[model samples]
Target: MSPTPIAWQAETVPVAGIALHLARAGAGAPVLVLHHDIGRPEPSPFDDALARSFSVLAPSHPGYDKSPRPDWMRSVRDVAVVYQWLLGERELTRDLTLVGLGFGGWIAAEMATMAPRAFKRLVLVGAMGIKPERGEIADQALLSYIDYVRRGFADQRAFDRLFGAEPTTAQLEQWDLNREMTFRIAWKPYMYGATLPHLLGGVATPALVVWGREDRIVPLECGERYAKSLPRARLAIVEGAGHFVDMEKPDELAQLVIRFVNEA
Candidate 1:
C-alpha cells in the first residue's frame, strides 16, 4: 500500500505588525521552519515530508515573496525577536520543534538563544550563524546566478530548476527583493554574528545540527562547531548532499528530525 501525500495549508497572519505568509500542515506536534535566502512562501518537498509526522509551519521571511519587510528589520537578531513575538501570538511556545535551513538557521539560532525555554527541540540544516575560524563561507553575493545554483546542490543537475526554464519577470523581481533583504540583514556581519557562538553556549534546548557532507557554502566544520558549542547539541552529516540538505535529502532529513523529536 502507498502512503498519503501531505498537503500544506497556506495563510497570511499578522504578527507584531508584520503580515507573515505561512504554509502549514499535519497535526501531532508543532514544527516551525525558518527558510533559506532564495526560498519562497509555498511548501517545498521538505515541508511535505515533515508534515507526515508533525505539524509544520514554514514562513517566508520578510521581504521575500508576499511577506513585507519592515524598515527596522536590519539584522538576523531583529527577525529572531519578531519570531519570538510570533510564537507567543500564536500560543505555540510549548512542545515546539524549530527547524532552520542555511540563512534561516542563522535566525533560528538567534531565536533559540533569546528564548531557550520556548521550544522542545531544534534542527539546523546547513546553518550559518558563526564565522568559521578556518575555511570561509561561500560568497553567494559575488557569484553569478548559475554558479551559485551549481554550488548549492551536490548534484549539479538541480541547477536546471533555476536556469533550465526561463524565469518570469515576477520571479526575477522576487529574487532581487530576497537578495536585497539578505544583504540588509547579513551584509554588515556577513552571515554571522561575532557573539553568536558565545550565546549558543548558553542555549539549553536540545539541538541537532544537520549538514551536507559536501556543502560548498557553509562548511561541515560549522556544523561541528555548532554541535560543540550548544549545551545539548549533536551533529548529523547527510551524505551526497550540499548546502541545501533539506532540498536534496528531504526524506532522510525528515526521518532524522522525526527520530530526534520522538525521542524527546
Candidate 2:
C-alpha cells in the first residue's frame, strides 16, 4: 500500500496562556480535530485526508504531549472551555466543523453543549462521555497501550501502524504522560459527565456520530446514546472497524465526515 500523504505544517499556536502544538493544512473551511487519548500531538493519516477539502486543525490537549497543562485543568468541561477560548481567540467560531475521537469526543461534546452555536458541524467517533445504562465503556486506563490497541482495532495491522511492535523509550515516556493526562481528566467520572446527556438535547448543531460496530473500548451503545441525546444527529457504524476507526478506516471516515459537513 502507498504511504499516506503528508501535507500539514506542525507549529505552535498560543492559546489560553500556553502554546498548543498543532498540525494545520488545506485551504478551504476549517475543521478542528480533538484527538483521542492515545493520539499524539502531530497530524495523522486522517488529518491528511481531511486536509484535502478543509483546513485541518489538530491540537494537542493542554495536558498532553508538549503542551503545558495548568493545574486547574481537570475535567473535560475545563478542556472544552479552553478550546472555546482558543476558537474565539483565533476567530474560528463560525463555519467550522469540530471532530472528536474517544476522549477528545468527550471534550467536543462538552464544548457543543456549552456554546451550542459555536460550530457549524460536529462529528463524534466512538466518543466517551455518557454512562451506558447497560454495558460499560472499557477502561483503557488499566490497559497497556499495546493491549489497548489490540482491543481497539478490528484489523491488527492498524495497531502496528500506530504503535509499532515496540515503543522507543521516548515514546514510552510520552505514552505515560498522555495516559496520565487521560487519568486526570477522565478518572473522576470514569469518562462520563453526569449532566452531559441532559445538556446535549439543547445542541442544535448538525452532528454525525461514527462508531466501529465492534469497538470494544467505548462500545456502539455509547454512540447510540449520543445520537438519541443530541437534537440533530445521525449515527453510522463502520463494520469490521474498532475503536480506532480513524486509523483503521481513514478514507471511509473522511468520506463520512465530508458528506456530513457538506449537507445542509
Candidate 3:
C-alpha cells in the first residue's frame, strides 16, 4: 500500500480579538503543540512523531509566523491568555495535553498555573519560565541565525538538512516580524517575569518537564526546580542535546510524552 498521508490542516481562529493561525494533524484526543520562541508551527520531526499518536494542534502564538498581532498584546502571560481563549473557542477546554517548547513552554506553564483544572497533563520541553538565581539569562534575539542553529542542534548534519540554506525571502520577512514582536514583549526581563515562580507552584496538573542537559538558554537546574515545585511532576534530561531538545531528540521526547499521557 502507498504511504499513509499525514492529514494536516491549517486555519485561523479568533483568540483575544486577533485571528491566530493554527495547524493540525491526525485524529484522536486533542494535544496542543506550542512552538519555541524562534520557531513556528511547522512540521518538525518531533511534531510529526507526536502526531502519530495525537490529534496535534499547533498554533502560531498571536505575533509569531503569519498570525495577526495587535499592539495591546504584551508579556508572556498575554500569550497564555490567548491560548486559553483559543481552547475555549475550539471547545478544547477539558482533557488537554499541552506540549510547549522553549518560550511556548513558559506560556504553557502560565496557562496551567492560571487554570490548573483545564489541562489533564502538561509537557514542557526546554522550557524557560523560572528564574536562574546565578547565571545570566541568554538573549535569544541577539543571537545570529547561525548561532541559533549551532546552539539548538547536537548534530551538524541534521542542522544542515533542517536549517542549512539561508532562509527564503518569505521566511526572512516572517522572522523579522517574529523578532520584532518577541522583543516588544520579552526583551525587558531577558528570561522570565517577576511573578512566574509564585504562580508555578499553583499548577495542579500532572507535568512532564523535559530538559536538554546542555541547554544554554534555560539551564537544567531550572527544570529541576520546576519539577520540584509542582505537586505532580517529573524531570527528564535529554543527553547530547541543547535548547531545542525536541528537535534534536524527537523520538525520545515522543516516547516520554506517550508514556506520560497514556499513564494518566
Candidate with best lDDT: 2
- Give the per-residue lDDT of model 2 (tens digit) for 1-264: 875576778788787677877778887999999988876534377888898899988888987986877666678888898889888888999999999988899999999998897789999999999998888888877787667768888988777776776756777778788888888878877989999999999998999999998899886889999999999999999998998889889889999999999986
lDDT of each model, Cα atoms only?
Answer: 0.85, 0.86, 0.81
In model 1, which residue pairs have backbone atoms overlapping below 3 Å? Answer: none
- Model 3 C-alpha lDDT per residue in residues 112-204, reported as the tens digit of each score: 998987898999988888888777557767787566546676666556666655556665666677878888778778758778878777788
Cα displacement (Å) at residue 134, model 1: 1.0
Clashing pairs in 2: none
- lDDT score, candidate 2, position 145: 63
Please write out the lDDT profile of model 1 over residues 1-264, one tens digit for every residue.
545777778798897688988888888899998998876434366788788888888887877777888777788898888888888888998999999999999999999999877789999999998899899998878985556656878986654553454556666667678888888888977889999998898788999999999999998889999999999999999999999887778789989999999993
Better of 2 and 3 by TM-score: 2
RMSD per prediction, one decimal?
A: 1.9, 1.6, 2.0
Order of candidate numbers by lDDT, starting with the best: 2, 1, 3
Best by TM-score: 2
Tell me the number of clashing residue pairs for each predicted model. 0, 0, 0
Greater-TM-score candidate between 1 and 2:
2
* Model 1 TM-score, 2 decimals: 0.94
Candidate 1 Cα deviation (angstroms), residue 232 = 0.5
Residue 145 CA displacement from its true place in model 3, Å: 2.7
Q: Give the TM-scores of the predictions, in the order they appear.
A: 0.94, 0.95, 0.93
